[model samples]
Target: MRRVVITGAGTINALGASVAETLEAMREGRCGIGRLDIRDVDRLTVQIGAQVRDYDEAAHFNRQQIALYDRFTQFALLAADEAIAQSGLTFEGPLAARAGVVMGTSGGGLNTQDENYRAVYEDGKNRVHPFVVPKLMNNAATSHVSMQHNLKGPSFTVATACASSNHAMGQAFQMIRAGMTDVMVTGGTEAMLCFGGVKAWEGLRVMSKDACRPFSATRNGMVQGEGAGMFVFEEYEHARARGAEILAEVAGFAMSSDASDIVMPSKQGASRAIAGAVSDAGIPLESVGYINAHGTGTAANDKTECAAVADVFGHHANDLMISSTKSMHGHLIGGTGAVELLACLMALRDGVVAPTIGYEEPDPECALDVVPNEAREARVDVALSNAFAFGGLNAVLALKRA
Candidate 1:
C-alpha cells in the first residue's frame, strides 16, 4: 500500500488565524470561547461561542468574490491558501489532473441561508440573491477549493455531522493509499455561529451557556465554534521526491457506525473504530501516546468516549494521554476533527500535549489522564484523533511522527 503523509496544515479558528498561532494558543491552554459577536445576539439563549473574531471579509476577498462566497467557503479558501503555500506544490499539468479536494462541512453557507431567510420571511423581502443556491450548498467549499487549486480529480464534500472532517480526511488518505490520486487537499470548515445557527442549536439543549468544560463534573454542555482546518495529504514517495516537509504520516484510518442512536453515542461503535484504526496502522495499543478526543463537554459524550477508549486499550488506556481542544476552541462541529488533528501533530512532532482546558473536578466515569488545565511535554511516536458524531458515526485516524 502507498503510504500517505501530511505535508502541510493550515487553520483559521477561534484560537488563531494560522497554524502557528493556534499551536501557541493550545500550548498555553488559552480559552477562545467568549461572548459571540453576531447579529441578533440579544435573542440567543446561548450567546457564547468560539467565533473567528476580527475577521474582515473585504481584507481577504474582493467585492465580487465576497458576494458569491459564503462565510464557510471564505474560511475554507483562506485555510487552503495557507496549506497549499506551505506544501510548496503548485498544481499544474499532470499534477493538477491527479490532485483533488475533499472537504467536510455540516452547515455549509449557513450564514447565507440565515440572511436570505431573514430577508424573505422576517423582513418581508420578495427576492434573495441569485447565487444563494450554489453558495449555500454543502459542496461549495470543496468545489471552490478544487477550482482555485486546479484539482481536477475526484473532488467532493462529506457531511457526517461531527465526524465529517475525520471521514473526509480518512477518505483522502485512502484515495492516495489506493494510488487513485497523488495528492489531496482535505479537511473541513464551518461557519455556523450566526444568529439562525445558534438559535437552531439552542433547541437541542446541549449547548453550554458559559464555557465548555469537557470531562469535568461541573460541565454544562458543548459550546459552538466557527472556523476551518485544511491540510495537504500527499503520497509519501511523492512528497519525499519533492523534499516536502512532512508534518506527520497518515498511518491508518477506520470508521464505524452505531446503527442504534441518532443523538447519543455508542461505546461499542467508538471502540471498534478506535481499535480498528490502531490495528490498521500495524501499531500496538501501547504505541499510541495521545488522542484528540471528541469530548463535547456534554455528560453522555465525555463518559461514553472515555469508556470506549478504556475498552479498546484496556491497560494501555491509563498510560495514554487524551485531551479535547474543544475546551479551548469550542466545537466547530464538522470542522472540529480537522482542527483537533493539529493537537495530534503537536504531540507527535513538538512533544507538547494540548490540554483539556476548563476542566475543574474530574468525573470518575472519565477516569483517565486527560492532561487537564495545562499543556504537557511528552515524547510521542504515534497519536490518534477520535471523532464520534451525533449519528453514531465514528472515525478514527492514526498518525505517526514523520
Candidate 2:
C-alpha cells in the first residue's frame, strides 16, 4: 500500500491566527469562548461564540475581490497561503501535476446570502451585487486554493455539515493511496460568525449560554466558532524526494452515516466508523495512542462519542490520551475536522498532547480521561481525529508519526 504523509499544517482559529499560536494556546488550556463581540448582540439569547477578532477582509483582498468572495473564502485563502508557504512545494516540478486541493465548508457564503436578501427584501434594493453568485458558491474555497497554488488535478470541495473537513482529508488520503495524485492540500474553513449565521445556529437550540464545557455534566451545548485549517498531504516517497518536512502519515480513514435522524446523531454511527477506521488502518486497537475526539461540548455529542470510543477500544479508553481542542477554539462546525486533524498531527510529531479546557467537572456518561486543563507529554505514534456532523454524517481519520 502507498503511504501518504503530511508535509505542512496551517490553521487560523479563535485562539490564534496561526498554528504555533493556536498550539500554544491549547497547551496552556486557553479558552476562546467569550461574550459575542462581532456586533451588538444584547438582544440575542445565545450571546457568546468563538469569533476571530482580527481577521480583516480588507487586508486579505482588494475591494473588488472582497465584493466577489465571501468571508469564508477569505479565511481559506489566508490559510492556504500559510500552508503553501510551509509546504515549500510550489509549482516548480512534476509535483505540480500530481498535486490537488480539497476543502470543506458548512455555511459557505451564508453571511453574504443573508446580506443580499436583506438588501433586496428588507432594504428594498432593486439589484444585487454582481459577485453574489460567485461569493455564495460552496466550491469557492477549493477553487481559490487551487488557483493560488496552480493545482490542476482533482480539485473540489466537500460539504457534509461539520464532517466536511474530515471527508475532505479522508478523500485526499485515498486519492494519494490510489496513485491518482502525489500531493494534495486539504482542510476546511468556515466564517459563519455573522449575525445571520448565529441566528441560524440558535434555531437549533443547541448552543451554550455560558461557555463550551465539553465532558462536563453542566454543559449546556456547543459553541459556534469560525476559522480555517489547512494541511499538505504528499506521497511518502515524493515528499522525501523533494526534501519536504514530513510531519505525519495518513494511516487510514473511515466514514459512516446514521441513516436515522437529521438533527440527532447516533452512537452506532460513531462506533462503526471508529471500528472501520481501526480495521482499515491495519492496526490493533491498542496501537492508537491518542484520540482527538469530536467532543462538541454538547450533551448528545459528548455522551454518544464517549460510548463509541469505549465500544471501539474497550478498556483502552481509560489509558488513551484523549482531548477536544474545541474547548479552546470553540466548534468550527464544518471546519472542525481540519483543525482537529492538525491537533492530531501536532500530538504525534511533538509528543505534546493538548488539553481539553473548560472541563470543570466530568460527566458520568463521559468518564474517559479527557486530558483536561493542562497539556501533557506523551509518546504517541498513532492518533485519530473524529468529526460528526448533522444529517447523520460521520468521518474519522488516523495519522501516524512519519
Candidate 3:
C-alpha cells in the first residue's frame, strides 16, 4: 500500500475557470448565482442558476473534438488539462502506463442527448448524428482523457448521482493506496444548465425562487449549476521521490446509503459517513478543522445534515467552521463532490474557511458556525468534504494538510 497526496487541482464553475479565481470569489463572499437567461424562464418557478458564462470551447478543444464533446466534457477536459499541466507530468516514461483517469458525471452528454432527442422525436428526422454514442456516453470524458494523455493503467467513470465526484475521488484514493496506480486524474463534470436537463430537475419542486440559503430558515431549495473540477493524485513517496509539488494528502473516505427514501435524505446516513471517515483517517473527531457541507439549502438537507454533524461531533460541531459553497456555485450534482473537494483542499492549505455565500436568517435547526457570507482565517489541520445524493447515496472524504 502507498500513501496518496494531491499534487494539482483545477476547476471551472460560475465563480471562475481556475481554482485561484474561485477561491478569491469565495473569500470576498461573492455570489455567482443569478437569473437564468440562457433561453428563458417562462415556466420554471425558479429562474436563477450558477451558470458558467463567457467560456470559449474552441480555445480548449479543436474543431473536430469540439463537435464530439458535450458541455460537461469540455469543462472536464479543460480542468484536467490545467491540472496535468500544473503537475508537470508527461506522457512519456513509466508515467504513461502508470497514470489513469477517473471522472464523475450525472448527465454525461445531456446537451447532446437533448438535441438528438429533439431531432428524432420532434422533427421526425430520418437520421441522427453518427457521433452521438461517442458524444453522449457516460464514459466519454474518461475515454477522451485516456486517449488525450495516453494513460493506459485504469480508466473509468463513476455515476452516483450527486455523490458521483466524491465516490470517484474516494475510489481513486483507495486504488492509489492499494498500489493499483501511481498517478490518477480524479474529479467530476456536469452540464445541467440546458433546458431539458433543468426541466427534469424542476419536477422535484425544490428550486429556490430567489437564492440558496443553506442552513438558513428562509432557505428554499437548490439552484442548478454547470462546470467541472479535477485533481491530480499521486502516491506520497512517488511524488516526493520525483520532487513533485505536494498540495494535500487524501487522509480517509467513507460511503453509505439511507435505503429509505429517494428524495429525502437521512441524518443517520450522514452521521455514519462522518464517523466512518473520521475513523478511516485514524484521527480524533476533534482534529477536523472545517467541513465543506452538502448543504443544498433545501428544507430537508440543511436540517438533517446539521443534526448529523451535531450527533457525530457533539460540542466539536460548534467549534468547527462549516460552509456550503453551493450558495455561490449552486449545486453541480454529479460533479459537485469534486468542486467541494477543492473547497476542502483550499481550506486545509490556506487555513482560511470560505463563507457560505447568501447565508442569512438564523435557522435554529441548523445552528453552527456557518462562516456566514464572510471568509474566516483559522488554523486547520484536517478538512472534510461531503456529498449526499438524491438516491440516499453519501460519500465523504477527508484531507490532511501536506
Candidate 4:
C-alpha cells in the first residue's frame, strides 16, 4: 500500500482566509462567532453565526464567474487555488490523469437555493436563473474543482452531514493507499449561513443564538458558520521525490454508522470508529497526544463524544489533550471536519493545541483536559480528528507528524 501524506492545505473560514491566519487565530483562542449579517436577519430567531464578514464576490470572480458560482463554490475554488499553488504541482500528462477531486458539501449552493426559493415562492417569480440547477446541485463544487484542475481521475462529493468532510477525506486516503490514484485534491466547503439556511436549522431547536460553548455546562448549542478547507493528498514517495514540503501524514481513517438513531449520537459507534482508526494506523492508544473533538456544544453530542473517547482509550483518555475548535469557528456543518483537521496539523507540526473558547463552566460528564479557554503548547506526535455527524455517521482520521 502506498503511504499518504498531506503536502499542502488552504482554508477560508470565520477565523481567517488562509492557513497561517487561521492558525494564528486558533493560537490566540479567538472567538469568531458573532452577530450574523445576512438578508432577513430580523426574521431569524438565531441571529448569530461565524460568517465570512466583508466578503466581496467581485474581488474574487468576474461577472460571469460570479453568476455561475454559488458562494460555496466560490469558497471552494479559492481554497483549492491556495492549496494547489502551495503544493507546486502542475496537473499534466500522467499526473493530470491520476489526480482528481473529492469535495464534501451537504448544502451545495444553499445560498443559491435560498435565493431562488424566495424568488419563486414568496416573490411570485415565474422564472429563475438558468444556472440554478447546476449551481444548487450537491456535486457542483466537486465538478467545478475537477474541471479547473484538469483532473481526470475519480471525483465525487460526499454528504454525510457534519461528517461529510472526514468521510470524503477518508475515501481519498484509501484510494491513494490502494494505489488507485497518485494524488487527490480533497476537502470540504459550505456556505449555509443565509436566511433560509439558518431558518431551517432553527427548526431543529439546537442552534445557539449567542455562542457555542462545547463541553461546558453552560453550553447552549452550536452556532452555524460558512467556509471551506482544502488540501492536497499525495503519495508519500511522489511528494518526497519532488522535494515537496510535507505537512502531515495521513496515517489511518475509519468510519462507522450507529444504526441506532437519526438525530442522536451513539457512543458505541463513535468508539468503534475511533478505535478502528488507531488500530488501522498501527499506533498504540497512548501515542495519540491530542484530538480535535467533534464537540458540537450540544447536550447530547458533547457527553456522547466524551463517553466514546473514554470507552475507547480507557485510562489513557484522561491523559490525552482534547479540544473542540468549533467553539472558535462555530460548526461549519459539512465543511467542519476539514477545518478541524487544521487543528490537528497545528498540534503535530507546531506543538500548539487549540482551545475550546467560551468554556466557562466545566461539566463533570465531559471531564477531560479540554485545554479550556486558552491555547496550550505541548509536543504532540500523533493527533486524531473526530467527526460525528447526524444520522449516526462517525468518521475519525489519524494523523502523524511529518
Candidate 5:
C-alpha cells in the first residue's frame, strides 16, 4: 500500500482565518466561543456560538459566485484554495484526472434553507429561489470543491453527523493508499449557526447557553460552531518526489458503528474504532503521546469517551496527554473532526499540545491529563484524533510525525 502524508492544511473557523492564525490561537489557548451574531438571535434560547467573526463574503466571492455558492460552499472553497496554494499543486493532465475531492457537511446549505423556508412559510410566499435545490443539496460543498480544483476522479460527500469529516478523510486516505488516487482534497465545512439550525439543536436540549467546557466538572453542554477545514492528502512518494513540505503522515484510519443508540454514545464501539486505528497503524499503544479527544462537553459524550480510551489504552491511557479543542472552537458538528485534526498536526509538527480550554474543575470520570486551560510543550511523535458522532458512528485517525 502507498503511504499517505498531509502536504497542506487550511481552515477558516472561529479561531482564525488561516492555518497559521488558527495554530497561533491554539497555542495561546484562546477561547473563540461567544455571543453569536446572526439573524433572529433574539428568538433562540441558545445565543452563543463560535461564529467566524468579521467575515466578508463579498471580499472572497463575486456577485454571480455569491449567488450560486452557499455560505458552506464559500468556506470550503476558501479553505481549499489555501490548501492547494500551500501544496503548490496545480492539477492538470493525469494529476487533474486522478485528483479528487471528498468533503463532509451535516447541513449543506442550512442558511439558504433557513432563508427560503422563512420566506415561503412565514411570509406566505408562492415562489422561492430557482437555485435553492442546488444550493441546499448535501453534496453541494463537495461538488463545488471538485469543480473549482478540477478534481475529476472520485468525488463524494459524507454525512455521518459529527463523524462526517473523519469518515470522508478516512475514505480519501484509503483511496490514496490503494493507489486509486495520487492526491485528494479532503476535509469538511459547516455553516449551521442560523436561526433554523439553532432551533433544531435547541429541541435536543444539549446546547450550552454561554460556553463549551469539555471534560470539566462545571461543564453544561456544547456550544455550536461554524467553519471549514481543508487538507491535501498525497501519496508519500509523490510528495517527496516534488519536494513538498509534509505536515504529518496519515498513518491509519478506522471506523465503527455502535448498532445501539441514536443520540447516546457507546464505549465499546468507540473503543473498537480507537483500538482499530492504532492496530491499523501498526503502532504500539505506548507510542501515542497525545489525543485530540471528541470531548463534546456533554455529560454522556465526555464520560463515554473517557471510558472508551481507558478500555483501549489500559494503563497507557493515563500516560498519554489528551485534550479537546472543542472547548476552544466550540463544536462544528460535521466539520469538527477536520478542525480538531489541526490539534493532531500541531502535536506532530510543532510538539505543541492544544489545550482543552474553558476547563475549570476536573471531573473524576475524566481523570486523564487533559492539558487543561493551557497549552503544553511536549515531544509527541504520534497523535490520534477521535470523532464519535450521533447515531453511534465513530471514526478515528492516527497520525505520525513526518
Candidate 6:
C-alpha cells in the first residue's frame, strides 16, 4: 500500500480565512461564534452563528461566475485555490488526469434554493434563475473544484451530515493508498447560513441561543457555522519527489454506523470507529496524544464521545488532550470534520493543541483533559479527529507529524 501525506491545507471558517490565520486564532483560544449577519435573522430563535464575517461576494467572484456559483461552491473554490497554490502543484499532463476532487457538503446551494423558493412562494414571482439546478446540486462543489483544478479521476461528493467531510477524506486517502490516484483535492464546504437553513434547524430544537459551550456543565446546544476547508492529499513518494512541504501524514481513516439512533450519538459505534482508525494506522494507542473531538456542545454528544474515547484508549484517554473546536467555530455540520481536522494538523505540525473554548464548569461525565479555554504547547506525535453525524454516521481520521 502507498502512503498518503498532506501536502497543503486551506480553509475559510468563522475563525479565519486561511490556515495561518486559523492557527493563530486557535493558539489564542479565540471564539468566532457570534450574532449572524444573514438574511431573515428576526424569523429564527437561534440568532447566533459562526458566520464568515465581512465577506464580499463581488471580491471573490465575477458577475457571471457569481450567477453560476452558489455560496458553497465559491467557498470550495477559494479554499481549493489556496491549497493548490500552497502545495506548489499544477495539475497538468498525466498528473491532471490522475488527480481528482472529492468534497463534502450537506446543503449545496442552500442559499440559492431558499431565495428561489421564497421568490415564487413568498414574493409571488413567476420565474426563478436558470442556473438554480446546477448551483444547488450536492455534487456542485466537487464538480467546480475538479473543473478549476483540471482533476479528472474519481471525483465525487459526500453528504453524510456531519461526517460527510471525514467520509470524503477517508475515501480520498484510500484511493491514494490503493494507488488509484496519486493526489486528491479533498475536504468539505458549507454555506447553509441562510434563512431557510437556520429556520429548518430551529425546528429540531438543538441550537444554542447564545454561545456554544462544549463540554461545559452550563452548555446549551450546538451553533451553526459556515465555510470550507480544503487540503491536498498526495502520495508520500509523489510529495517527496516534488519537494512539497509536508504538513502531516494521513495515517489512517475508519468509518462506522450506529444503527441505533437517528439524532443521538452511540458510544459503541464511535468507539469502534476510533479503534478502527488506530488499528488501521498500525500505531499504539499510547502514541495518540491529542483528539479533536466531535464535541457538539450538546449533553448527549459530549458525554457519549468522552465515553467512547475512554473505551477505545483505556487509561490513556486520561493522559491524552481532547477538545472540541466547535466551542470556537460552532458546528459546520457536513463540513465540520474537515474544519476540525485543521486542529489535528495544528497539533501534529506545530505542537499546539487548540482548546475547547467557551468551557466553564466541568461535567463529571466528560472528565477527560479537555485542554479547556486555553491552547497548550505539547509535542504531539499522533492525533485523531472525530466526527459523528446526526444519523448515527461516525468517521475518524488518524494523523501523525511529518
Q: Per-residue alpha-carbon lDDT of model 2 for 230-321, expressed as tens digits?
A: 99888899889878888888999999999999978899999998888878989999999899999998899999999999998999988898
Superior candidate under lDDT, 5 versus 6: 5
Global lDDT for candidate 4? 0.94
Off by over 4 Å in 2: 92-94
lDDT of 2 at 122: 82
lDDT of 6 by residue, 1-402 (tens): 799999989899999999899889999999998888888899889999999898898998899989989999998998899999999999999999889998899998899999999999999999988998998998998998998889989999999999999999999999999999999999999999999999999999888998998889999899999999999999999999978999999999999999998998999999999999999999999999999999999889999999999999999998999999998888998889988999999999889999999989999999999999999999999999999998999999999999
User: TM-scores of all models?
Assistant: 0.99, 0.97, 0.98, 0.99, 0.99, 0.99
Instruction: Give the alpha carbon lDDT tens digit for every residue of 214-269 in model 4.
Output: 99999989999889999999999999999999999999999999999999999999
TM-score of 5: 0.99
Backbone clash pairs for candidate 4 read: none
State model 2's lDDT: 0.88
Task: Kindly report which residue stretches of model 5 are placed more than 4 angstroms away from their true locations once superposed.
Answer: none
Number of the candidate with higher lDDT, 1 or 2: 1
Instruction: Give candidate 6's TM-score.
Output: 0.99
Candidate 5 positional error at 234, Å: 0.2
For candidate 1, write residues 221-262 as lDDT tens digits. 999999999999999999999899999999999999999989
Tell how far residue 187 is off in model 4, in angstroms. 0.7
Tens-digit lDDT track for model 5 on 129-208? Answer: 78999988989989988988889999999999999999999999999999999999999999999999999999999988
Global fold similarity of model 3 (TM-score): 0.98
For model 6, name the residue pairs that clash. Answer: none
Best by lDDT: 1
In model 5, what lDDT does residue 10 have?
Answer: 91
